[model samples]
Structures are given as structure tokens and as C-alpha cells.
Target: MDVVAWQFLLLVNPNDEDAALQQFAAFRAALEEAGGDADPAALLRDVIDWKAGFHVGEDDAAGLMDALDELASRWRQRIDWGLDDDADAVPDTDAVLQTAFVQLRERHYSLWTAETGEATLSGWITHERDEEAMQLVAGALGLSARPGIG
Candidate 1:
């Protein structure tokens, strides 16, 4: 039997409401240009509802996931991985993990809001399996194939 993967919830920071709408428009245009039969207005509605913690239907969910995955893939490709000698060096794994945590926290604050304003994109992923999901995310992010981490 094939293992199922839990869908990953990707939270993107669009910077503001205008940017989010623009991004959604671009996605809609691309889908239309590709002859996709999905309704752009409905898709946008689902995305808006998604931000409010509502469950989108399977087809719409899949479409949103695909759009996010494509965006992430493009962004990942643009990353420049290089180590600078002048950069600060961490002394140990614990320090590195701490630093990572701090960064993640900072990012969360920067990308999320508590008021009625749009500055970020957030969604959830659900699946019966965890390992498969991790693998998929690793592959999507262009990381080496290492098990047990997402």
C-alpha cells in the first residue's frame, strides 16, 4: 500500500492586501491562459475564506495548494546559498537551533496580524501520513533527501 502524505500548510507574506489581490489575479490569469476550467472568482473567495479558517472544497483546496507550491518552487530557485567568511559563526548546534527559532519567531510576527488587515497568507495542510508530507516539502524546498524532517 502507498503511504499518504499530509498536505503542508504554507503561510506566505504578501506584504499587504493589495499585493495579495494582485498575486491572486496573476494566478487566476495564468490558470485561465492555461485553459483551466476553475472559476477565478470562486477560487478567490475560497482563498479569502481560507484566511478565516474555513475549509475549502477538495478541488479548490487542490488548486490553492498547487498555486502555493508553484510560488514556493519559484522562490526556492531564486535563493542564493553561499557562506561568507566574514559572517558570524555559530559555536554549536544548540546555538544554531536557537538562532533558527528566533528567526522563525521573528518571521511569524512579521508575516501575521491580529487585527483586520491583510499582510500575510496562511493555510493548513491535512493528510493521514506525516513522513510522506515531510518528504514532499523537502523536495519542494530543494533540500537534500533526508528523512524525518519537514
Candidate 2:
């Protein structure tokens, strides 16, 4: 079997928990609405059951954790820039650019492939404060903090 690996990160603002949850609800509703003949719940369950197979070495696990931390730090920096600046004025350009990159990364996940192997890691990162707003906050934060992108 050919090997493949994928990684995804999602992020949300610490202050937008309600909006995130609402978006998630809307997504679910849209899915249900589109399921003309099939059961929405069953469809969701089946999708969740489809897991990509792969393996992570100890070093890879450690690296993943480090990447997550970096992402979170970058998100926090951007948020701080927004909070410390005038509301009517634009925030720091560097922060804004970083945040934008974070958004893009969260929207796209990476894929890796190798012979006889495949792996997919999909998730998000955000501030602890944004947990209630979005489930993928963590993923978003991490992606933003990544070097060269966020």
C-alpha cells in the first residue's frame, strides 16, 4: 500500500466563540439539509469512522507539540496587537499579515505520501479563551505560528 500523510490546522479568535459555534451549527444544518435520502447522523458517523492509517515516531510527536506551541504564540501576539491598539485604527501591519496567513493555513491542510504508508492530522489551534467559540481554535493558532506562513 502506498503511504500518505496529511496535516491540517484551524484557528479562531479568542473573542469569537459564539460565532464559531454558530458556524459549526450552520455547517451541520447544511449537511442535514443536503441529505435528501440518506440519514445525516449516519452519514456523519460513517465519515468520522474513516481514519487514515499512519505512524508517528517519538521525535515526530515532539516536533508536532513544538509546532503547536509556536502557532499559539503567534496567535497571541496578533491578538495582543489588536487589543493594545486603537479600535478605530488599523492594527499593526505585521500582525495583520501574520493573522491573514494563519487564516489561510487553517483553511488548508498538508498532505504527505510515502510507499506503504499514509497519515493525516487534521485539527486547529486558538487561544484557550476561544474554545467555546470554535472547536478548531487550537489548529488555527498553530498554523498561524508556523514559520514562513504565519
TM-score of each: 0.27, 0.24
**On a 0 to 100 scale, what is the lDDT of residue 104 in model 2?**
34
Writing each residue's lDDT as its tens digit, candidate 1 over 1-150 gives 001111122223222445455545555565567465654323433443434222222234334333333333332322111226575542332232233224333333111111112322233222223435545653453323322111
**Candidate 1's error at 79, in angstroms?**
14
For this target, which candidate reaches the highest TM-score against the unseen true structure? 1
Tens digits of per-residue lDDT, candidate 2, 41-123, equal 23222222212112232235333333343444444432223343345544343344355345434544222211112242322
Error of 1 at 91 (Å): 14
Model 1 alpha-carbon drift over 4 Å, by segment: 1-11, 37-102, 106-149
Model 1 TM-score is 0.27
Count steric clashes of candidate 1: 1
Instruction: Report lDDT (CA) for all predictions.
Output: 0.32, 0.32
The CA lDDT at 4 in model 1 is 14
